[model samples]
Target chain A: MTFWGDYRGHGHPHESSWTMLGPLVVLAVLSIVGGFVFNVPEILSGMFPIKEATENGGPGEMVLTGISVAFGLAGIALSWLMYVVNKDIPEKITSSLGGVYTLVYNKYFVDEAYDAAIVRPLVQGSESVLWKTVDAGLIDGTVNGMGTQSQGVGSLLRLLQSGNIRSYATWVVIGAVVVIVVMGVTR
Target chain B: MNLLEILIALPAAGFLVTLFIPRKQEHLTRSFTLIVSLLAFVLSLGLVTGFETGKPGQQFVDNVVWIANPDIHWHVGIDGLSLWLIILSTFLTPIAILVSWRYIHKQVREFFAFLLLLEFGLIGVFAAWDLFLFYVFWEVVLVPMYFLIGIWGHDRRIYAAVKFFLYTMAGSVLMLVAIIYLYTLAGTFDYATILDLFRSGRIGLSHTEETLLFLAFFVAFAIKVPLFPLHTWLPDAHVEAPTAGSLMLASVMLKMGTYGLLRFCIPLFPVAARENASWINVLAIIGIIYGALVAMVQPNMKKLVAYSSVSHLGFVVLGIFSFTQMGLDGAVYQMLNHGISTGALFVLVGMMYERRHSLAIKDFGGVATAAPWLATIFLITTLASIGLPMLNNFVGEFLILQGVAQAKFAWTAFAAIGVILSACYMLWMYQRVFFGTQGKEPGETVKHHMPDFNVREWLCVVPLVVMMVWMGIVTQTFLPAVSATDASILDQAGTASALARPPVPPTGGITHGGSLHAR
Candidate 1:
């Protein structure tokens, strides 16, 4: 009653936790009565259809089965209690599990460790010594020097292709005069 | 037509068809290329259906004399080693075509033609059963890749392309010399004949010759594998290349080296392979750890992925040298898994690039909200790349580990670290891209009004997602085909020696040393 809200069921005699608790209590009582009165074999057997042996051949066999049944019943009771306790929990309690979930989802910073241990050192070392000195200094430097050399050669080549028609004609005339001079000298 | 002949000839036909594509209607030319590529793919698909998994030696084999003069024949076959690789190359090209559909607007005819030509070369490499033929296919790959990068790549494209070409060519030249020498010794270019001769000890090379030839082949394969110290050119090529080019290099091209090692070096020269196996194992382990460490720190996502190839391919190398059945199968499986998973990854990364025009990991966050599909695809591909159990990568990695474990405990332990490192980098990259706020700064055209993947992107991704799941679960179909071959490989490695030992008798039981191999 103290925990009851302003809903219409508040004042009703039947509407209480005791009322809900009554059925479970009655069921337990009925089960005990039914076990002795009807000698229900199903009740005697937990799940399997086989009947328990009644021979008092050994205490050990009885003790083990009894322990097993006790454990099973205890597990059921504990689990039910857990269900009741956890059923009304709020989102905050549930989402607290996300912390560990996120860590797994992020796959635990092994990449960072590898980077620190191996990649950074190798990349840095190579960039400084090998790449700069050999790859760039020797390889690219050699290639670039070739390019610069090609440009030097290219400029000299361009001097030959200058758009001077008169120079071309003079060169042709000079070649002819040289040919005539050579022919006359030979004669 | 026989499957092997069809496998070889279909692509050659495609190569021919691509030539006849009219220059005027460039779109028509593109359509022709697509049709030819689709035809080749269909022919390869015929392989999956017809492939007999339990029987592991060569199947659908067609060998015949092509040259009468010098004793060369058009020999080709598909074993477990070559089967999936052929399928993977065939599968990716059409998708590559579709991806390039919009992006490669300029030189429409040439792009598709080169791609088709490239497909032809790759298929030839996978199916060639002759040493001379294999080397021919090997060198054939260079031209298309060079053009693909040089013509279409972004920023210093020519430089990257030339470097790639030069490096591969230099390696191949030495390999060529080795191939000729092998031909001289064996007096046949036939692969099976040479392998049989090698196994029977009929073909013998002097120790110096063996070392030289091994070095020749090793240098060639290593550059392609781009094992640790020689791996410098990879990042540049990957970063500068087009999406399809990057995908091709990461998924397929890297495997060429490991495949060469298994096909040509180890089986052809088992003595030398066994002699130098430990040194190879050491280098492979270094590549594994070193690649992972470097990948972990990469600012550029493409560079990270490129470095990861070095690591992932390192596993393939380790698996190869483990000299166990599990190891060889794992190496082959890893090769295929790398193709599927990494191919999917590059595709997704390409979609991201199309939107943002940047590959810097820090450039965006919480993209999951805008493009839920993109985020989901990226996450799944990332998981596969990380080799999560039930995924395709996991099976291969697990097998490789078991193989290495049986051989050397310390090697297996070090390789396991690479596994942990893989999970680290992949998951970290995933979180940074998908979680937190989904926005970018102003004035960056790509990011400012960046819309998520449209219909085209979804079409590209859905198949990859389906494949990732399907290949993961039904790995039996893939595994069974290779198991017999793997067993034979283990037989050669003497792995059966240890396997034959009886299980340790339980406590209080008599040890059965008399009949150890009985069980």
Candidate 2:
């Protein structure tokens, strides 16, 4: 076996077994020495404004801090017990909750509720009301209606384009008479 | 010929030549269009080289009388605001031609002819100094794009094409009336002359007249920007358009709307823009959030990218309305960045479509394993799209946020939610399409036969990817050009507003951070 391969599976007896921890040990040592040398904690405390409140030492502030730390620790302990130490505890608790458990498990059916309430209506409304009714029925209907109307008007107007000079002259004379009558009355 | 004239004429000349090429000669038609687009791109570089940074006005001007009675001039030039956009147009056209190389089969000659025509119209829109010319070019863009989408597009092409045309045409009619009114007042259609007249109070308009005129132009551009409710046409148009059409639509064409806001809308009606800034910013913020939310649920890949453009462009509009130098600069830079990143995304999606003949997200799986190179590029673009740090989108988004924060902290906070939501949707889409198990079920008839990037595909994407990274890191290269223009815009807007109203105390004017403060 190659030396590295063997070492990966099993360590050499001559070497210290803790040699793998070398980097961590070095980091820890440096951190300790550097913290003391540089007064790191004091410097970091100076960076935060909350230090002023702490320095005032009000009983209210102390009580709030105490409550926060206590709750934080309790939460961590409970998570550890439920997740790492005894995972079945969570299942037991969930079973006791019954319907509530299902509710949480299914995310309270929020997605389904949203679909029924919002998405479905929106999709249906846009597809039918907005697109079909408004767009096609109203807008396109108006636009295409104009085109069709123009075409109908053009076909009707085509009657006047007959290539007969006598007929055209008679229409012009009649139009002039109507125009003069209307103009005279309006004036 | 001056460089600007050559830039405009080169594409037109190519378009004319493309018409004479026989339909069967596809290779000749493709190669000729490619060469023409590349030549235009090369000539446009001359503008960059000759351009004097920090110069206050338009360069390489080629003005001549086109219509004497109407006093219409064929005036064209590039300011700092337009210079990069012009380069962006030139840059993307060749890539677009390359993208359509194999995709467009029917009416090859006509396809390229329309493409060149579109390019010509786009370049002219950026370069034109005459409002009439600008309006003409603006309308000219619609014809080819209309046909490109209608004829060459996918399912629902006709409906999409008609909708696109009518929507844009309806908005622009008001603008045409407004332009004529301005011409009647100023007795000219030249932008500089009209701007001078408006600035000097020679062409006096009541507050109501100015606001109404502003709305006319704003409605036109807002439709083009397709902000929110007016954005109904964009998804259908983008989804139906062929690969190259989407690339052009998302890249350079959309910028025209934002560019008009910068060039004509704000500068021409500064008092109105200032008066209405709050409402416009609100709409922009809504669009940013609303677009991102809608994009998250999109099943179609192309639709997702299309919606993202709405969201991305919301930032541009937001930045413009912020009325700060940083904001304007970011808006302009974001336009180019969106062109590169989103344009590349469409190209990538197009390549996949070519292979699978499908864009449904469910149809893709383990594509990363099948095509690592494609996935790599897609991931980079996805990052850029979501504004990941060290990519192009981040710089623009950051600057926009900073600018917005200076103007309105609350709006900036809301716009930041869009940034997070973008990351969520993009990464989620990326994971689903790329990381899962390979292929569909065995019983399915369509067998998975995904191939990685071939040589031609690489050619299309490499430049875009390079640009995303380069623009992110060395943003100074592009920002200096934009800064001068943005500074002038802000200065003019400031002067215009100060002239009209009392100076309000500065609110939320925090000092900017970052090394880019040199600007």
Candidate 3:
């Protein structure tokens, strides 16, 4: 089938379009009704003519309720107008204040700034200084250095183990003389 | 045989029997090892049944003389402190062996044999009553663990193994020298005798002598507990070692260090321990925060887990240094909690590695879609590791924070940040691996290879998960057993030294109180 034919024949535009708006409208209406329903307890109590009813009733409460409802309805109407009736208004306003729009669009560049100021340096420092220089170079170097130093000492000591009778005799004679001289001096 | 002797000897006998098992009979070897570990675990439970709560001294005593010249003895026993740790050792061995069944295919006989040998050494380390015996067992642990890592470990295993050996040995040699010096002064290698001698003021130590001896043992245990700067060897050893090795290393082996601190360091040199506690607490806090921060950035899963262990164990050290009954109890309990949670995490990671053969975080995603059961268990373990309430780690971490808060409020507040950081890293890793839409790159043909836990793996992990919940819920059940011992240790330390901190009130019978002695 051709694309246009498929779109016209298969797509139920009226049903699908209503489905998108259905939940939002229902929620908005329910919330508005619910706001009044929440005052039922107070209204019912007022109708009972209790002794404290007149004491509790005042113009302040009425005025506060009127103001709240006025603001709430105004907000809802504005949202509907901006979102559905005149969708281009938000884009126009944002474009008019281009600097603030860009600021909000880029999330104030906080993440980029952090990456530049903190994360990059941290990662680079850890890799170069901590891992490379400290862990691998300094710490491991010192550890391995101990091993090599011991090995060097062992090899140097091994030189004295050379199997030579004349060398052993000479070393024994020198050791005996040194021992005798040390003992005599101490005594 | 006496219960403690059998508890120690069963594993030794298992090691001998494993030696005779033909290398080709892998199943037989595994079964034998499991059976022996199971028996050891069952007998270790006898310590619980036979143990009298609130009792002050060591039970299941098995003392015998071994050498005459330096007055050494084959003395071994269990107290409230050592009993749970002994049970922890025996408990993890069977699980360790079971987890290694598939992972360790080559040198099957030697692997199981060394594992059993390591178990024997670990039990001895916990149970030894004599200084010389403790030292012997301590060194014995090093040899087999070294071979376990070097033989069956991942690439770079040799370097890891050697570093472990050299680092541990360097700390231990100083300890050996100190032990010899103490022997000369007290004329015996018996722990009780030397402790009594020092306690009774018969063997007097000048200030320098006290500090030196304390440091000698402190360095040894700290390296093992791996507090802060001394902790560099742990990540390397943990990452390079096989799964079972990592489990034991994180679970029971690291406890040896903290246990040593409780068992020997504080009691032997209270003045120095109390004097140095401030700096030690500083190190502990540093380790707690440093470890978690480092873990947050780890690309390798095993390394991340390894760093978490450093963080968790730091709390244990912090608790011990806090020197309150709650702190020490939490420290001991945390030792066990870490074993369950972190060990289980390692096992899960190992299972994943077996399937995918890669431990890099980027290598896997949306694993839950493929293996929901495995993912669920991973999430549970991750939560437990992060100290979620009603999980094992939470009770321990809470108690530790409570304890440290009393001792050093600032340290506790800072250490609490580590808890948040732990959650950050563990959950972030979990999310990256399990919750995403794709576990691998698109068109990756090997996606079907990964599978959930089978019956054997379930058997391995079920006990851990159960214990994690059990310990978290009924902390009261475990706390009382160790409370009396913790109190006595602190009491002795407090009485021996002119401690600057206020005396910790006795913790006996005060369940859930906010005091340092809270049961």
Candidate 4:
């Protein structure tokens, strides 16, 4: 990975200052010497109990430690050979990994997953379902529906509003006949 | 003249005066409206200073016969519950005036006139002790708010205004029918007289009649609170309303609904309130969670704040229905807290709108960098809104949750999620607006139009922020009066204020102890 940078035969030395490197120097010393002098995990454990490492039940701790160190060194060697010796191999390996490489490179698609499950659905639902369907469609629809329904009834009744006296006489006669009939039936 | 009479009259007089102010003299119009509202606030403070705590009753009362046949009276007063609410109305009126000072350029005279008229309606709503008078004040609030949103608002203002008007009118009409029915039975619209008649059993309501009446008043109030399914109008109203209009609508107008629930609905029909608590609580919880979930995805800022109101007010509704003194007190306190926090949120939103002429979240980036002072005030308000500990909302929400836990622990657990979701939406909206990835290279709007807080903006915000802190930390200044009033409300209803002292199991047993007035 270091070899992957633009490393010319001769490089220009960058400007350095105590304000910049002074902290770096202290951090470097702390990273090395602070580990033994002050154990962070040990200190933190008193306040917050650290979770015990899982028992894989495959091998003992000693064997697992040795295996992890060996694999770490092998990873360095492999990276060196791929990047320094032949830069093309890294790309080839990445291509071979394909979807897995993409997934891991995007940090296991955590942000994508969150967007898909929570964020996008909420936005889509709010816009399309809650706002559009429930609010604009159902609630407001019912309210407007009442108005339109009344108007429809009025339009039907409007036909009976003919100014002609003949139609009015007929409605009056029909009203009298229904009243008499209902009165007689009740009697 | 009685102080309450003067408090009500000052705004009415100011409204007429502002109406006569030449529309060309915009500065005079603004300054006069501000002065009137400031005077109203000052007079309202007199109520607080003279307010005798540890008494749960109406004070500074004024009565006069306004109508003969129906026995309607111009009755008005303040109580422990309505004291701060009245003050909240008076306090926010000037803020609303300041909010609209520069923004409302076209209808300067009429706008200030309408703003003063709105203050009058709001103060009247909190003060009116007679049912007819209350109804009048309630309907009066709608006219100015409708005009505020309609004339001064953004696109679709007409639609939002009409919808807001119709929704409130629909619910209030039912309430009117109920009020008339009560008057027919009791022979007067005076609240105290009717209470005396009902308590003495001279005026009786059968179970069915009581339930129906309760539903009528509750629906009216619920619509105002805009609980859940009925709340579709609020987002539209808040989003379409001008800055000052949104401030008043959120801060005081919405409290009218919760206030009605506490003042009229529960006291007049305690049995029905108790019987219906199960479903009302259900609706409130649904409102809490649903509002938060819906707000989480709002692309627009005003709409987001509007939905958050739905979530916050849900706690108030829940508290009201819980049938415990703690619950009632919490509900009342929460009302004041919501007024301060949400009112501040709307003002802040309006301030931002003034800069960019946009309410869309995506239109903003690096606001904190551009306007650090604005961002700082906004952060304080946001924290206050999300019920951050030692803020106004925290006290209200905590008391509400504690009260609910005593009545029904399950509800507290459910309602607590809303508290969490509140933080999620508010902070997320805060982040996207103020501290976006565009901070490195600010957007065009952020670089050019957005500026730090002006004197007027600071003046508009700082007092609300101060109140938020004051109400949060030294709750004793407010809560004792609220407790006194709520205890009286429960007592008058023949209810044990401290019902279910042992946190009863949710096995149909909680209401047994809570409802001494239960049929």
Candidate 5:
């Protein structure tokens, strides 16, 4: 058995693409007709369960299904005819089809459009800049400041331990006051 | 005897044991905590098996007179509403302790002690039948969790801890005010008595006053549910938290919000709840979509899962507000589903982080070759979180969507986007982490470097994996237990909405008829 893509070698293999259109169109029509037949009953039933309907076949149902099948076949034939007519066209026309295909493939650049509209302003805005800068500078700076402040306080406390006559007198007075405050509070 | 006291006491015993255990013997502390948690879990399991689903309501009624003069009783009970949530909490705590056995090195005894203490508070909150005891337990949950986050957390631990503490504390304080007001009206501190009065229309509240009280409770629950906009603190907490901390926080602690909404907010203020139901669904719908969109763009895997919690829990809120039997059931189911799947994801993420020391998705690649079992577990869990059919998440999410569909087609339609976005982000993350080559080229360094699942990791995750499949297939086992509570809540919703309908037509007719006569 020959597969669909297996016959794509030399000599008028390109013509086979046009020949394959007839059955494709016929199948598409049959599917459309089948879908309409299935769906028309549902629409006619008006959202109610099938059990609710007193009778199944009315004149309206028969006519609707008939028209659906007719339209399906017409659609199939037209599609096949179009495919055949377009198949032997010039390379330029074929390349334009590829271009159209590419656009459809890329979803018509909706993502790019969204980026241009929303993300650029969000990323480039002053608030973002401020957030980034403050995040890096102010937040980190404060953490750094705490370390430096602790070190500076330790150094200042170290300086206090240096012995001096004035300091000694102050220390004695402070000790006397502490004792006095303790005595007063207790009393 | 009400099982409530035992629920609180079992963990209290664990907490007491932790104090006596020398702080230096970390292994002993963990083993004791694990045993205590196992005891509590067994007790919860007893509740699950013996629980009579259709019994009038609020089983194992443990009411005792704590204060005679003021008329406050130590009232506590388990009901269809809290039964599973309590089980989920107790089940995870022991697993959490086991997960932390190797990871936490310093002050390990203190860590396990805080974990048990935290479990005690959570169980107490769920089991408490008295308003005051409920409030006390609500605050009890905060302190241990605070220490857990602050003491054992990662870089910026203090910031995350403070943020979590402040956010929850601020919401809960207003809930205290609301509780006091309800107490004043009811002249009692028992939840059953207050609910009875509120339901009977004996406790009078103007629409404005009721709406205010509802908002107060809603805000507290929202912060716990961490419903969107109020959910800013969660990612930071999840990222900085220790592995077990993230597990309990995501799985158990977050349910406090939805639990409050069901147990307190809706039943107490039926009229106001009905009035705000639409608006609340709008918020929930926004959360469902917004969380997914945010998660889709996250580079960090842990934060991505954290944000997905926001998305997934939004479905729970949607189900609750939907006020349909299916919706409410789905909401409760989703709550459990979120805990299991997201908890497993966090554990998996934590395992990777332990090995690589990075949460960035970009840092991982081609790990499937080296760590096939780990990758496989992650894949199953990722599919579950994405609500793929035949997984636990699917049942809850599908029920939620069905409930939403019945209430409002548009709301469900909007929520459907979240499902798509979830698949996109989760699969993309999985592909990045596992499916491709680790290094730029297929080299020996990348091929054989990453270690796969070890014995400990396998033990930790095997139960979760089995559950993810079992719960997904046989959700009937879980759903029937919550059916009675869901039905009652749906009835209340119907009554409130039905009452509003009669007034609407009369007012519309009066205005139209009066204008016609004047003309």
Candidate 6:
């Protein structure tokens, strides 16, 4: 609809946004003619490499090109025949094959197929496996675990700063008794 | 007084002067601090210009009897190993000051004073040859950094400061004990003399003694390096530290650990170093992969960069442990590279924080649109951080990998994974933070408040950016000096390879030594 049909929106068109449109048009032109203008394999050299006549698609290439161009022209003519010449034909086709037409109209569930096949898995896996599980859950978890363990030990040791005279005296007595007992046993 | 002496003293004097500058006279304190740091940087450049690269051993030596009872001397100098590091310290200090010009508000004088004080300690770490003086300067560095993080830092500043202090202290006290024990054994705290004594067989370490002493020093430096398991304090400290503190901690201070490894550990306890290399390299590899993975998941910018340091420094440790000339040279080169690249990252993160008042990655999007120049500089820094070719890190990492490949091809393989992971986290962070749709959550904040590098910021960052390019392209200008020191260190370490090596071929002294290291 965008390329072959009219752009019939109700908004007034100001000067086209050349900043965005310019490169896109340039790329569109390039796609149509750039291959003929430049040799891709020769430019890329090792990556693509120029081929001999057999590798370069000799007669087989011509047959494939002819087939592809014929199908393309046929599709364009059919669209123009149904829409421009006899508009009732599209309705008749849709009525004849209702469910299949709906399926075809919805683009054969391709977007859903793409989401299931490629997009969802990547997004979900990157989040859960890469970021959350490996990075945060394991590595950072270990780091924080070490921090907490150290803090636990520190908390246990902080009791020494209790400032209780009797507790200190008792510890000192214990130390002295232990020292004396060790000395006597060694002797 | 020697130029090295002046270089060390200049910061100490600036620190003292900054301390006396009254808090009310804020501009005076700021400008004076800037002037002092800049002057010191200028003085350091003299050392660079005058540095005779092919000359071996310490240059610009100074010695004074600091204590009579302890027999401690204030001996200081720089070899190729320390020269660039000291220059990095001086170079980063003024920029740290410049970046903090507006960031620090409450205790302006005290903050700048501590920064200079931190400079004083860092230089001393790099410069001091005597063990006791090294320890003194070592302790000196901790105090100001403690206050800097504790005072000016984010919410958990106190917790971070204490943890940073305790972790370092835990390593330092054991080191002190070892230093004292060594003194009792050798009757002096002079490093060169002790090395000479050890070489001449006048004094010796039985195997157990060397290992223990090596551990004592190694653990302390390791804690600072925050190598692997001991690195927990680093993330907390970095996350909480103010911009200047983070910049210093990431850049110059971490080098102290790698520098210590080269300067003291390998040379002083060659047997112990060799014995420990397998396990240490394992830990380094673990740190490399682990840090990059953790960095990947971090929501906070500073935390991501902090973990990246762990990964980057792991490469350095691997290089050092590889026990090859390529390894040591690469290790030292990586030290300077990390100081500049990571330092610049921290500074850039700080700039973003200043605008957004948040470190959360989610808080920023399309920052490139708002601040194109800032984004450009950051992209360059990011590329540098990931060891892109023609950047400073590439040369260092390549050398390290080559060296490690020579030692153990397996270790090289593991370490190489880190290089790829570094690119993953850094470029990911850049894309999310810089290239996305502008003004998502903090859209209004960024569009209005986020300006590109102002004059002061440009002044601060351009030097660092230029340095990244300068060091990357002109490796020869720096490597000759570094290679010299690394060679001497390896020779002194008496590695198995060195011990089993052929004797000097007629031509003696540095030319033969220089030829040995030239590869």
Regions of candidate 4 where Cα sits further than 4 Å from its true position: A1-119, A162-166, A184-187, B437-445, B495-519
lDDT of 2 by residue, A1-187 (tens): 2322225556445754577679778889996577447754457776786666436545886588679879999998888777777768988999899999999999999999998997677556645665467644775577667658878999999999998999999999999999999999999
DockQ of each: 0.06, 0.08, 0.16, 0.37, 0.05, 0.14
lDDT of 6 by residue, A1-187 (tens): 4444556889876667889889999999998889779866566666644456326655887788789989999999998888777778988999999999989988999999998996567546655785578555775577567679988999999988789999999999999999999999999
Q: What fraction of the reference interface contacts is present in each model, in order?
A: 0.00, 0.00, 0.00, 0.55, 0.00, 0.05
Model 2 Cα lDDT, one tens digit per residue, B85-150? 999999999999998999999999999999999999999999999999999999999999999999
Ranking by TM-score: 3, 4, 6, 2, 5, 1
lDDT of 3 by residue, B1-519 (tens): 589998899999999989999878999999999999999999999988998888778888877888987799988888889988898999999999999999998999999999999999999999999999999999999999999899999999998999899999999999999999999899999998888887777778888998999999999999999897788888889889999999999999999999999999988898778778878988888889877877877888998899889899999999998877778888988998998999999999989888988888888887888889999999999999999999999999999998878776788899998999899789989988886644456633335768888999999999999998999898877888788888889887766653322454555321122223323
Which residue pairs overlap in candidate 5's backbone? none
Query: TM-scores for all candidates?
Result: 0.72, 0.79, 0.86, 0.83, 0.74, 0.80
Candidate 4, residues A49-158: lDDT per residue as tens digits? Answer: 65464333245855876798799999989878887888799799899999999988999989999999987887788778876787679977887787689889999999
- Candidate 6 clashing pairs? B439-B443
List model 4 lDDT by residue over B68-187, tens digit each: 877988888888988889889899999999988899878889888998899899889989989999999999999999999999999999989998999899999999999999999999
Among the numbered candidates, top TM-score falls to 3
Q: Write the per-residue lDDT of candidate 1 for residues B398-505, one digit (tens) a residue.
A: 989888777777888999989998887788777777776433643222225357678867777777777778778887778777766666554543432222223435
- Interface RMSD (Å) of model 5? 7.5
Q: Which candidate is the best by lDDT?
A: 4
Candidate 5 matches the true fold with a TM-score of 0.74
> In model 2, how well does chain A match by TM-score?
0.52
Residue B179 miss distance in model 1 (angstroms): 0.9
How would you encode candidate 6's per-residue C-alpha lDDT over B306-374 as one tens digit per residue? Answer: 989999999999999887899889999999999999999999999989988989887787889889999
- Model 1 residue pairs with clashes: none
**Candidate 4 CAPRI grade:** acceptable
